[model samples]
Target: MTIPQEAIEAGAQTLFEESQELDQDNSWDDELPEEWREAWRYAAQSALTAALPALERQIREQVAQEVEELKLNPKDSTTPHCVEEYNAGLTNAAKIARGKDQA
Candidate 1:
């Protein structure tokens, strides 16, 4: 399965953001040796690198599930809303599957 560059970038950004939050005081990693911190950072980045494809797949599956749910709930008076949501989810899922950005 081809994972989108956008998804990879997003995953990396998320990691970075979370790390930033964890280090809000700018000293969260200060207790560790510099080399150890470097190694830990490398490991974290490597993990993110390895997990991006699976993450993309998870996103696709979740979108598909949402679309299916919307389809199954057509009995409600919000048919138009459900249809719109289903279409949007399906479209986003297709885009992710194809390694493309949402339209």
Candidate 2:
């Protein structure tokens, strides 16, 4: 089938106008080929999927190791230090309140 020149010109003009609009909008991603975008997305997703389990396992192992170390040396744990500080503060506050009541 023979295509008319007017139809070809119209199609070309439409493409040119769309390209100009895309350029004005300044979206560089729109210029990338669809296949390239799809492949990049797939690779990124695959990498994340592959790495997530190892990342999670590493985090869990580190936490468990820290917990075990804390158990082995409870004197170095922040929890005991915080509890002692809180208790001391409470005792001081009680003494201050009692002194005010007496006054």
Candidate 3:
């Protein structure tokens, strides 16, 4: 299944923001010049952008593997009750990954 672009962006943005917060909370960052901080952020964003495709591929592969295992040995009474439930599961997973949902 193709993950939504919005979900991917949200996850990436969350990660970037957390990194920034960590940097800010570090006492060493206070001595750093604004230029240096900006450069670090730029490099971080660039690295994340470059890694997105591989990250997405890995997520997809893992999800597919889990789905296959479920098909082979499903614990639920049904594979999925309906398409809406399946979509909800995907949406909920995205939310949890993005730190927008507790469960």
Candidate 4:
């Protein structure tokens, strides 16, 4: 199944911003260690990788519950569909971790 462009962009934005935060020291004048910054960036990126879909799942579940409460259809497909999306994220994360070209 195709994921939304907004979701991909949002995930990329979150990963980049968090990586930047991990690499910066606002209180400092000199640059951070190159090695350390790279390491931290990848670490934060991976953590975001694992977290984004899980976070999305929890949020989707809560919203689904709310919709069920109101006897309305939820915003998503079935649980298996959501799991497929989550697995896709995990697969993409692995590709990224391997430095594979997405194209």
lDDT of 2 at 87: 53
Error of 4 at 53 (Å): 3.3
Over the stretch 37-96, how does candidate 3's per-residue lDDT look in tens digits? Answer: 556555556666777788867776666555434332224546645644665666566555
TM-score, candidate number 1:
0.43
On TM-score, who's better, 1 or 2? 1
lDDT string for model 1 (10-100, tens) is 5545555577687754343356466645554555567776886887778777765654554434355466687667767776776665556
Give the lowest summed-lDDT range of ten residues in model 1: 68-77
| Per-prediction TM-score to the true structure, in the order listed | 0.43, 0.35, 0.43, 0.35
Q: How accurate is candidate 4 locally (lDDT)?
A: 0.53
Please tell me which model should have the higher TM-score, number 1 or number 4.
Answer: 1
Global Cα RMSD, each model: 9.2, 22.4, 11.5, 14.1
For model 3 the local lDDT of residue 72 reads: 24
Candidate 1 overall lDDT versus native: 0.61
Candidate 2 similarity to native, TM-score: 0.35
User: By summed lDDT, which 10 consecutive residues of candidate 3 come out lowest?
Assistant: 68-77
Off by over 4 Å in 1: 1-30, 72-103
Candidate 4 per-residue C-alpha lDDT over 23-96 given as tens digits, one digit per residue, 9 for 90 to 100: 94332224646664455456555656667676766665665444334332224546666656665655555444
